[model samples]
Target chain A: MKVTVKLFASLRKDRFAVDDFDYQEGATVGHILASLHISEEEAAIIFINGRHGGPDSPLKDGDLLAIFPPVGGG
Target chain B: MESLKEYLLARAENGLIRLSIQAWAVQNFGLTFPAAEETILGLNLLPARYQRNQRSLSCGQQLSLFRSKVAVIGCGGLGGHIVEELARLGVGNITIVDPDTFEEHNLNRQLFSKLDNLGQPKVAVAASRIKEINPAVTIVSVYDAFTSRNGSVLIEKVDVVADALDSIPRRLELAEVCEKSNIPLVHGSVGGWYGQVTTQFPGDYTLQKIYSRYIGERGIEKDLGNLSFVVAMIASIEVSEIVKILLGEGSTLKGKILSLNLLDMEFSEITF
Candidate 1:
């Protein structure tokens, strides 16, 4: 299965902004973050196909995953 | 009242009343400046302070803005700018909350922070600044944090709340308070060149949805260090949302988030 991954804000530093990669059928969001060397803490919100998804949420083939970092500041 | 209206009409300059003239009315009629302003706006005459807002906002809309009350949480980067704009934009009543004093580090972005007043309370400085900008505005300065205990009272009579807090947990607490009170919250946050804004109505739970996992008191901004322009931009957007809410004009970021990256110049509207 293949999934499209998009990173935003500071998460794009020294990393690809958007790309597609092959993952196992049962791959989860946490798996993709780990592969990208991003800790779960660094990924604040995750969206799969424009809907909120969790790190433990499974990704299906042709899924478009987007990850954003926490930007809470005054 | 008829005499005052006639005087205002006679003194009007091209259907606009100057603040100095309004001050004269306030002195003669023994009325507050805002009261005089309300009378002027009621007569469909524009306040000179809001001259630039004309055409963009009719006299009726300006009157509504001058009659609205808004609470701004935190007096840091976002809060300072938010108060400045709200005051200049003629928001009648403003409640500013912050427990901290101006620090050396805040001078970079906090609008009210200056080299001369580092140790002064943020809310006090904000109140004075609001008066300097627009005396018609009534300011409520709170010298304390917006905790769950005080949040309800702080926003009890407010029509709208702007979240300028820096802590995730505190933002969540504010959201809960506004939700319980059924007040709309215009939320903005910044980190370096990145910022995001969203308007959440009562029961929306958008804050909880966006901030549930990040309750550690801070976010990426702790490392990124918020820039001046990012804070100002997000603050302006938050104020715009507040104005829209007050005047019932234009669409706002009600059910979506506007995420901006100044470095990349990318703006994305994400719906949740």
Candidate 2:
């Protein structure tokens, strides 16, 4: 079960500058966070392909994930 | 290509917008089917119960669910306008949390700030105005200031959050809430003669990049009332971002920062 992952804001620093991630089957959102080396606190807003699913949510095949960190401006 | 407005109006109708909506379709969309028209009644019809109030919200076929709860972290210059747009659009529920109250100095750009409201709480004043404009909306007032402890109180139970704050610390704090809650945060900021808006839905560009590369650390300062012009402009864009996100209509500033400078009236987008 391959799933896509995305990283944003402060969490972006832990991985590639771009927002991209891929993980193996039966991996929890938390597992992907660990693979990307992002702490639970750092990796905020986990979207399983645009839905509001969290680390505990199971990832399906071809799932384009997104993760954004906290930001303050304006 | 359909312009942003046209795109949203496609699913809208002339009634009370319940949930899952983007943009202000009732106030904005053209009437396809005609309804009754009187002195106060517009093209749309409010539910009979609310029709008596006259300030009821317009309805639509679907309630663009993503907009169910909109928490505006501030209620100042820009936050005022953002609240107005959200409420008038029948956003279902609007929660405005602001620690400050109206002052004589806030008269210039504050939409809900009037001479009589000079000493009133911003959240209270703004919510009252929203109620009068559209009683169908549920206004949540957080008279207390936004902080790490109270972040969940305001951020939770909402589908999306908008950042129209004044300082770096507050914006960052709210951002943390949206991040942890797995909610998309549409962030905006303005300086003298300039402002910017962006959307961070957990999997997009980080706030640090936008702040460091573009905004720098310039604090909000008063400069010839540039706050109103820039705030109003940015707030409109913030509403636009909110609408698009709610309706799943089109693209968003997900990984981009939109910059607008009144000095030259130039607007552009940058990907970082």
Candidate 3:
């Protein structure tokens, strides 16, 4: 399965801004984060196809996943 | 002061009244500038001070702005800039809440912080700065934190609240207060070159959705540090949302979060 991954804010500093990867069938959102060396704590919000998704949420082929860090400063 | 109305009417030409007329009315009728201006506006006359806002905002919209009250929590980084813009936009009454005082480290991004005000209360500095920007604006500065006990009364008089707080837990606490009070919150946060903004209306779980996992944890900003540009940009966006809410113009970020990364210049909106 081919999936597009988008990392925002500080998450992009050490990671690719956007990239495509081929994952095995039934890859969970957590699996992709772990593969990218991004811990669950590092990614504050996960969006699958523009909607909120959790780590355990399963991803399918052609799904766009966006990850954001918590930019919680005044 | 019955003749005051006729005097103002005489000075008004083509439905537009000059600030000088307001000055005259203020002096003659012992009314404040805002009072005189509001009276003339109520009579269907436009004040020349707001002439620039004519087309962008109808007379009615301008009046709505003048009648709106907004509370800005946190007088640092985000709060400072938000207060400055709100005053310039002619928001009639503004309540500024913040307990911390300025330290030397805050000069980089806090708009009201200055070398001379290194130890002054943030709210006091914000109040004085706002007076300089717009004298007609009424400022109620609370030199305390917005806790559960005081949150309700502090925001009781405000029509809307701006969440410029720094902590995740405090933001959640503020959300609870806003929800209970039935007031909308325009939320903004920044860390380094990244920032996020969203509008949380009554019953909206926008904040909870974004910071639920990060409760009691300081944001990455502590390590990345906040930048001046990021704070200013996010603050401007927050103020724009407040203006939109007050005038009932444009679409707000309700149920959505607008995440921004100045480093990559990418802005993405995510809906829950």
Candidate 4:
């Protein structure tokens, strides 16, 4: 399956927003995260389909994942 | 008397029990502030006696009620922690300004540093992090360094400002702008396992005075020490001062500078 990965902050710096990526059909969040090239320790928080969800959570075929880096504000 | 103190702390909202259970207990009890005295008092503890932490931190809640605008300039080691604290504490609106791209070195403690974010712009990363923490908050990011050109505009936009900058020149510029705008500003820094913070309202204490009086004019040292924990401590202190400014109680560091050497855990405050 294919998905659109929108990255922000440091993640955005690495890749532009709305990047196209391939994911396994009904991919578990873990798999989609892997496709986005993010690691568990480095993952700040993952949002599936614009809502907060855990990593082990599953994903649909065309889910939009927004990934952000851990943040400390000024 | 306890009710008076609550009023003093600006717990003006109805029923002002907004204070954490711990702090409410201490405030209501005649026992001294933060009293070791058993709660033998408030927070739903009927006539029964109880012992627990005391003092009012409800300042954050009330401060949020006023919905002050704050600008946090930076999102790395110091900036990262500041953002997290402010979001959870519920500041009305916060604008973050940072132009640097996330780097590998930031991983040790920079809030937004992750292997996946190795090259992401800090401002956007930090902005998204704020959203995750408190979506209700308004967190805007300027993905550029705070140069003299844009610095003043940014200062003009926010009601209060916080300086978590790394360089002395940048810090000075920010401080001066805050002074000109008459905005309350909280300043913090970390180096060699040491961190210090100060709250300066307009016409109070200029950043220059604090820097030269204590830390000196040196820029970055050859090898900076652990900054994670130090930054966190300084940030919380910064947030506390912001809370004080918001709730309209407690003395701020306006005319004072607080310096800490985390190595031996020694802290001193100097008035300018």
Instruction: Compute fnat per model.
Output: 0.70, 0.14, 0.81, 0.06
Per-residue lDDT of candidate 1, residues A1-74 (tens digit): 99999999999999988999999999999999999998887788889999988899999999999999988999
Ranking of candidates on lDDT, top first: 1, 3, 2, 4
Q: Which lDDT tens digits does candidate 2 get at residues B38-75?
A: 10123243433333334422333124421377889889
Q: Which has the better DockQ: candidate 1, or candidate 4?
A: 1
TM-score of chain A of 4: 0.77
TM-score of chain B of each: 0.97, 0.75, 0.95, 0.74
lDDT of 1 by residue, B180-264 (tens): 9999999999999999999999978988888766757788898899999999999999999999999888999988889999999
Q: What are the iRMS values of all candidates?
A: 1.1, 9.8, 1.1, 16.2
Q: What TM-score against the true fold does each predicted structure earn?
A: 0.98, 0.61, 0.94, 0.59
Task: Please give, as one word, the docking class of candidate 2.
Answer: incorrect
Ranking by TM-score: 1, 3, 2, 4
Worst 10 residues of 3 chain B by lDDT: B211-220
- Candidate 3 has which clashing residue pairs, if any? none
Error of 2 at A65 (Å): 32
Model 4 stretches astray by more than 4 angstroms = A1-74, B1-66, B212-220
The most accurate candidate by lDDT is: 1
Q: How good is chain A of candidate 1, measured by TM-score? A: 0.96
Q: Could you tell me how far off, in angstroms, the CA of residue B41 lies in candidate 3 after the best superposition? A: 1.5
| Model 4: per-residue Cα lDDT over B1-272, one tens digit each | 44534433343233233334434545455344222111212222211111111144443343342266778887777788878777765565788888789888788788678899889898888888877655445777888888666888887757678887777667777877787777888887766555667787777654655343223333323244446777788888888787677767788887665756566565756455
Q: What C-alpha lDDT do the candidate models reach, one value each? A: 0.92, 0.65, 0.89, 0.63
